[model samples]
Target: MKTPPPSELVAEWPLPPLASLGSTVRAIGIQRELRRHLPWKMRGFLRVDGNQAVLHLPIEEKEAFSAASAKIATAIEEISAYPVLPSEVEDILGISSRERHKWMKQSRLKSAGTRTVKMRGRAKAVTFHVFDAQHIEDILDRDLPTIWRQEDAAMSAENRKRAAAKRRQTRTQARSQSGCAGSADDASGSKLEGWDVFAAEGLLRAPRK
Candidate 1:
């Protein structure tokens, strides 16, 4: 016997501009949030399509799909409140990992909070900072990363110059001290040689001379 085709239910939610900040990572994050409203088995049925979250389910489960879709719709309305992940920020801002770490350390990249996720197969978990979506969007619109990169470069150059000057000053001081010590040693040796010569010439007293 041949199997019959099952009817399917389809729905899609257009993601807001802030939902992803134009970053694919951000879009996927929103997609995952929508999936959370569905059963674990049905979660995989929801996926990100460009700037939208699309859901596909068999018509036989229309009730479950409708309930889940309502929750997901509500979630979409509040998607702007979602915290932007570290990777999403990197993508949205077009920054490298080093730049992200440096800026974050200096408080240039403000963190919303920290997130901890367990590895798929490892026993240990990884923790990282997450950023506010609005904050990130503001930064992107202002092209702040370019400005930040310039500032960081300038600061690094200044630090290098200061370090070099300090090293030079230390070397100069070392040389000055070494020269003084050598002069003192030379003076002491001269006195000892004179005494030895005088004693050899007259074991008694050369004080009269």
Candidate 2:
């Protein structure tokens, strides 16, 4: 039940592909018959049960069913070009989730003010959200691997900076607690043997459990 805003007005109505029908002579013939009785003007739901085609009328009709159905047929014809629900954008644009989000945040995946739809399979409706189809096509045309790699590098760098800062804070606190200025006995320097080149960068050893 996707009711356009009142201000938007149901200036047009369209029909969806007969989802419940199989692609067969009997099925397609039945669909063709059902289309005849469809209330296509303002808004209506078309349901076909066996040979019966039921056109569920709108709550309130401002026009004749025949007039509405004519408008609906036109609208339904135009719907053939629209992309209602696109599966994994990765498939359409050849990008990953992180890359997609990165581009979206940068307004590269879709132009500014662009929208992508949110579709409901169970409800059989497409929400107002819709992405720029041209943007997606450009993304597919451009090589986004480099951009994705750059994003990964920046993320890694940020993580490294945070880790280093945490380490520096830990070291500073440990030194303060030890109450030692140039305490040659900096316990963290390394576990040393009496006569050893303690001068060298401490051994890269695994930490004890």
Candidate 3:
């Protein structure tokens, strides 16, 4: 029924600059990745401090901390290997959800691959596109998202213009067809007008038997 002792073992690792890309969420992702490499029970002991993750454990848990520290160091070394997540892509690229979706769909923002992870409170796992760190960096460096957005806007505008032209052409054709039909009907009516005269002349009547 006593409080646990203070943590005496400590270690820290700076987050990878490319992985974090000055995004807090991205940094948190790196921290989460570090935690994943450690034992589940000890995961909470690791936390983000400024731009790095620090691990703290009690003196009695020194051996466990040592092992966790090694894992964290290894994980940090390979932090760039972690896939750039969808949210991270948005933040790092300063793009909207729609932009991200559009570019990804068009392969402008090419996905290195996909990653599946279970949501914290959900029974189902969600799968999404992940980008390579270098790929993201390249896109950011070239400001490709802005270019993609401009291209998308132009495409949408062109599509709308084409659609409008198609609609106009369809209407014109419909009107032309209607005019022809009306002319035909008028001509037929005019021809029928002679039928009365022919009937009066008995031409349209059967010969008297």
Candidate 4:
């Protein structure tokens, strides 16, 4: 059998604004997405430039490489325009799930829609809210997450203050009621003592004092 020349092929695509979106975490996510479409052995060999994902393979495997390249292109297009998933939103915004839920419910983070996807090995499908990419970008540019967190902390402090004030007022009212009851009991006892004294002095007809 004749030996064939060792042939290699390479392809790359820029990640554009995505590269600037979520920092290192986002890049790792993009790399994972790319690797998901590749073979396990090929996954570990994948390379990512600053904002570009590159794939290298043997020319003999051109067909597979082409297919993977096409998928990558499609992924890039979709990621560029697609609404942000909840996880992606958290990464890009640097917010926690609790904070995301709070902001979403408060209308601080608007929802573009919902996404339903079945687990790879499960029959059940999960649905979650998706956010507008542009809107998220705007929030990021404005550093809104930090602002919101600060606002939340301030509000929490205010709530604690109000709760403490309410408890103090309740205690004060309880003490006032207790004092009034004590005074009433003292008055009643004094009246009884006075009556006893009068009866003893008059009714008993005291002899020589």
Clash number for every model?
0, 9, 0, 0
Backbone steric clashes in candidate 3, count: 0
Candidate 3 C-alpha lDDT tens digits along 7-27:
588887777777687777788
Best model number under TM-score: 1
RMSD (CA, Å), each prediction: 5.2, 17.8, 6.6, 5.5
Better of 2 and 4 by TM-score: 4
List per-prediction Cα lDDT, in the order shown. 0.88, 0.50, 0.86, 0.81
Rank ordering of all candidates by lDDT, starting from the highest: 1, 3, 4, 2
lDDT by residue (tens digit), candidate 2, 1-209:
99774432233332344321222333343344445544444223554444333444444653564565564465445433333123335555455666666766766665334334356565554433244444444555576656767887999999999999999999999989777654656764666574256545455555567
Model 2, residue 49: C-alpha shift (Å) = 30
Give the poorly placed runs of model 3, Cα more than 4 Å off. Answer: 1-9, 58-64, 120-123, 192-209
Shift of residue 203 alpha carbon in model 2, Å: 55
Best by lDDT: 1
lDDT of 4 by residue, 78-133 (tens): 65665677788888888899999999999999999898989898889999998777
Instruction: List the candidates' TM-scores in order.
Output: 0.79, 0.37, 0.78, 0.73
For model 2, name the residue pairs that clash: 40-68, 41-68, 115-130, 115-131, 116-129, 116-130, 116-131, 117-129, 117-130
lDDT of 1 by residue, 1-209 (tens): 98887689998989887888888888877888878877899999899888888888888988988987898888889988889888888999999999999889889899999989898988999998988888998899999999998988899899999999999999999999999999999998778647878787886665774
Q: What TM-score, to 2 decimals, does candidate 1 have?
A: 0.79
Candidate 3, poorest ten consecutive residues by summed lDDT: 189-198
> Which 10 successive residues of model 1 have the least lDDT summed?
200-209
